[model samples]
Target: MCGIVGAIANRDVVPLLIEGLKRLEYRGYDSAGIAVIDGRDVRRVRRTGRVAEMEAAAQSEAFSAQVGVGHTRWATHGGVTEANAHPHISQGVALVHNGIIENHDEQRERLRALGYQFESQTDTEVIAHLIHHHLTQGADLLAALQRTVKELTGAYALAVVSRAEPQRMVVARMGCPLLIGIGEGENFVASDVSAILQATRQVMFLEEGDTAELSRDGVRIFDGNDEPVERELHQSDVSLASLELGPYRHFMQKEIHEQPRALGDTIEAAMDVGFDAALFGDNAGEILKGISGVQILACGTSYYAGMTARYWIEAIAGLPCSVEIASEYRYRAAYANPDHLVVTLSQSGETLDTMEALKYAKSLGHRHTLSICNVPESAIPRASELVCYTRAGAEIGVASTKAFTTQLAVLFQLSVVLAKLHGKLDEAEEAGYLEELRYLPGSVQHALNLEPQIALWAERFAPKSDALFLGRGLHYPIALEGALKLKEISYIHAEAYPAGELKHGPLALVDANMPVVVIAPNDRLLEKVKSNMQEVRARGGELFVFTDQDSNFSESEGVHVIRTPRHAGALSPIIHTIPVQLLAYHTALARGTDVDKPRNLAKSVTVE
Candidate 1:
């Protein structure tokens, strides 16, 4: 994922770096660029596609500068062209990157053996020719970006701009996400806070090996022994008018109607401070009473919200959970149970494989991490020791609805505070599961009032191409997050089994033009998900269900039911994920696609 923005200003910082690259264009829109400096030289503008075509090619040049840097790119080592865009300039420095400089081919062969002539197969133009080869040997610009980030390794979040330091803007981060943004005379830097949350909600958030410079009067930070630190700004309740789309057509239907106010502000701060396994660390109730097992990691819809919290932490935190998939748990080498309580999940806790799988489970000695994120200052909650944020604000839809129902309402309030700290629920069954999480935002507003009956089954699934979803015990990760929100915004070709694995082979790809979609939640797996929806209506599959009106499944002909007004026992996967996120936002608004930037997908993966 890419998207960066920087500014140092008293004025024309190229329209605040093109409105913070159009609010971090959902973290990467193929290509876009900007550089600025100007007086002493840098001034650039590249483009390949969106950021409104690089803001109409920076209004055909003469990009007035007050110091800048910007980018939008999502290309990794190189391809979406305008010569692999980004600010990536060289001699006069100018940069802009988001992760993956993985030893940029041995530092681009030691800056091409010191003659440095590369153009654009970018590892971000080899960090602008190794910061113009350490500012042409006499190191300056923050010691040539701290000696070209100590000769680079992996994951970055750079932002640079020099032209002999025309006012300033230098940034860095090791894993990914960067921040800053306190303004007035002007200072920013991004990678997201919804691109400086419309210029300043007083940020900071740059931790893992931080570095900063930004100046038109503030931000200094540096550490990783470059010393001078101090970072804690924080005033961001991110509201660019709740990221607008006011009457909603898409920010995925204004985050599927802001999932009942983002699951009532993520379980209303654990129902106002009661559910506590020490609210996740004051030694989290002595690590939830020495939690024996439970891994999680995540990716994609937070790995189906850690497979629906491994069925609520093994059915109400009796423990023994598992989940993985943080980019295959950081290249597969297992058995790291130093009292395994490692958890992760990331709405944009800069997920570079869930922050390298929580630094490979803290290098195999796990020591109880936790992150259930929504950016309490990213990098997996600053490399997790404990966190739970998921306020689920600012999702900016790259296919995630209210951050997967506020990370399943913070993994069902960390499985009811680890099932009441492992006695497996006491105190009136944890006050009846905190009064069913304070009545789960009215059962997710009765599943967003079944979005006009799932938009009348998304107008019969917007001319279906293929679909299947189904469910069973624990609604099979809510039918694999409703076939990954209908193949992430209706590219269709969906699938999801576990309705007793549908004849162990996906019922040979169900017929009558697919469309099975069950998740019939009434509980005890509703007659084995109604005999797997009668084996997808005895083969002419075309059922749809999403049940709950006491699930005696109805709608006669080929079966279609919509239900979901009540029965959310054990909080039915956050109320059946709001009618599977309004049937993938009304089937990607009936196939017009781009349901909030869904082509190649990039809300935040922060590069592999």
Candidate 2:
């Protein structure tokens, strides 16, 4: 996923565009560039590195413009070079894009036959040339973009400008995220609202196959059918300060520390008004009564959250549950029943794989579709029949921190809600569960307090080339998440296995050189986990145990124990998640790696 920002205003927009790109730096990018109309021609500055370098170049060259479009690109079809950077220009038409163009090679061949020259190895350059071709054939900027997009196939969010139309810009969204920001005497476009939040709080999230023309006058939108349409304008409450790294060294660290507040806010609606099936939608109660099972589709960390939910649903609600990775699920032949509810989880609801999996389930006659997402306006929530919003706020870090914990909090609530509806939980029992949810934020804060000790443990883990994570029962998914966090940020090789499976094959690789991390929360499976810990110990594997306060684990010989607050039943996974996050954050710090924007990883996976 890349970042796109555009503005049409009376004043110079170079500063605005640069600041927007900086705000979007957390999305992960290899190069940054901007294309602006200077008087009668387009002036461009491209860099092969960070946005700061490009900004410095723009300043040294005295580049200024009243209308412009900027981009931060994560390499997809091209190498990390300035020649392949965004703001790709062709015949005086310049554009920046996010998402893949599936038919790029075909289009490149067709354009080449038509005497159009290509400069870069990017799918985006084809878009610039195609639009310019249409403009040459007597089409306006909006009409040309409309004509150009019709020939392209695949996901893309495009922002284009032309030298002939200095005050005009056009933006389009096919299957990727693009939005228009409303400002006084000025309008903006960006892949994420956070990029334009400094200039405008009012935004309109464009739906599939929507294009809009932007100018100092106003914004005009047209639907897929080429007819004028109106989309709702939402007032974003994200503050400028929330996007900043206040007091923390990195956004990942700040987000890790914000887990308590994030969890509290995510479950606030359930806590305040009590859990009604209507909290999900108007007909969720009826839908819940008719469902015999749940089929969850998700990707990455959200998939792990779904894996954890599988344990909760089957045990608490007595419902059959299956968790499938969305990317793989879409390619396989799977059974989808109308009586089973299809649930999709994504932090940025625009995750293409999960969205496609939801469509595939729908195509197979599944009717009850629900989505758990953080961005309320994102595509998945809007596409699903029912929705649950996780209010984790803006998760800037490429490696998720707050978003993962908040997803677990929401999934836990869903489990309890299903139990109550199925007569598995009575009034008193439901109240007890609610009480546990009430104290969750404080429990998370207690876990946050373990940061000091975990940071010390991280120093010991920093030099290790590989690590093993082990857990049992409901905590096994927590182990998987821990290993993911470590590998994502620290670049260390890490793997997780159910504790019982450790003896089967993974034991052969255990030795003093390998560090073993175990999740031991004093549940019924505590003894089983302790047995696995011994298996690692016998092999002389250095052990790091994150246990509960009363678990009575001691630091002796090769064993190191970091205790969290006493386990909260059913919600222990969310609590155990805290220490592992801090461990990864601090480990990345000690290894001198990029924690916020991890290499080769984008915050949002907009393309499949």
Candidate 3:
């Protein structure tokens, strides 16, 4: 993932552009750059490191202007060098882009035939040249942008500033996310609201194939066909304090501790009333009642959230459920039932693969669609027929902590609602579940209280080369998530398998050098899980377990145990996730790795 920030105001915007890029550092980028329309010329500065380097480089230059664009580039088409940095200039036009261009090679050849020269080996440079080519043929900036986008393929969120139109900046989006921030005598544009939240909370999310023209006076929007369009400007509810790293060492650590609050906010509305179908949308109750089954689509951590939901839906609602990786689902000829509810889960809601899978499913006559997402303005929510907004706020860390747990909370709520709708839960049963739901935040806090003990375990794991995580029944997905967290932040080779599946294959990888993490919740499968632990111990594998307080598990030579407060009846998965997150956080701390922004990973996967 890359980031783009643009501004048009009455004052010097170089500082604003730089600060905005700093806010987007969580999105993960290698090189950073900025371009400003300084008087009659488009002045540019580029750096091959963090945004701080770019900011320092810009401080030395006299590139002061009222309009500018900034970019944080994650290498996709070329090497991570200063030359490949964005604000790729051609003729009088300078632009920064966020997504891939599929037709860049052909366009480059055509532009070369027309005597256009290239500087960087980037598909983004082609856009600059294409726009310049159009401007040379007597088209204005907006017209040139519309015409250039018409000839390009694939996803992109572009912000361009031109010397020909020094008073304004033009931005366009096709597949990737883009939004405009409103202010007095100024306007801002960025890939996410966090980038511009400091400037203005009032923002308008751009729809697919929409374009916008920003100026010091105001902002204007247009569709792909050059027709003027109107979009609602909504005020964002994200507090700037939520984005800060208060006393914690990193955002991941802060987010791990913030789980109690995040889960509370996510499940507050559904805790007392079970779940109101009307919270989704109009006719949502009818849609939920009519669905024969569920088909869930997601990627990465969100996919694991769906996998956990599959267990809850089938067991509680008594309906079959299937979970698919969105990327694989779109490429194959998968069977779709019109009566099956299609559910999509994502944090940013701009996940390209998941969005495409939803579209693919809809094209096959899967009429019922629901999106459980954190961002309300994102494309997935707009494309969905019903939406369950996860109040997780803005998750800044590349390794998701609060977002994943909050999503699990939402998914559990959906499961309870479905079970009640299907007549599986009577009044007493529903009240019991509601009481359990109300206590989930406290359960999460209880798990967090074990962090001091978990940190000691992390010290043992930090020096290890590999890890294996095991869980039984509904906790299996929790095991998978635990392994993913370890591999993502600590740079260890980690794998997860069902407790029963250890004998099948993964047991061979277990030894003293490998740490095996087991999630034991004292459910019906506790006895079976205990047997699985014996197999690990017999193989001389180091075992670290997170279980309920009432469990018989205790510390031994190779066995380490951290007990939670109590067993949450149906919401155990949500509580079980906190210790695993803290384990990864403390382990990464012990290894001195970048716990928040892991290498080769971004907070949001906007590109395929």
The lDDT of each candidate is 0.80, 0.93, 0.91
Model 2 agreement with the true structure over 1-608: per-residue lDDT tens digits: 68999999999999999999999998889999999999998999999888999999999999999999999999999899999999999988999999999999999999999999888999999999999999999999999999999999999999999999988899999889999999999999999999999899999999999999999989999999889999999999887888998899999999988888999999999987776787788889998878889999999999999999999999988899999999999999999789999999999999999999999999989999999999878999999999999989899999898999899888887887788788888888889889999999999999999888999999989999999999999999999999999999999999999999999999999999999999999999999889998999999998999999888788999999998898899999999999999999999999999888889999899887
- Cα displacement (angstroms), candidate 3, residue 541, comes to 1.0
Tell me the tens digit of each residue's lDDT in model 3 across 41-67: 989999987999989888987668999
Model 1 is weakest, by summed lDDT over 10 consecutive residues, at: 374-383
Among all windows of 10 consecutive residues in model 3, the one with the lowest summed lDDT is 271-280
Could you tell which candidate, 2 or 3, scores higher by lDDT? 2
RMSD to the true structure for each prediction, in A, is: 18.9, 0.9, 1.0
| Positional deviation of residue 361's Cα in model 1 after best superposition, in angstroms | 31
List the lowest-lDDT window of 10 residues for candidate 2.
272-281
Q: Candidate 3: lDDT over CA atoms?
A: 0.91
TM-score of 3: 0.99
Ranking by lDDT: 2, 3, 1
Q: Looking at candidate 2, what is the lDDT of residue 383?
A: 93
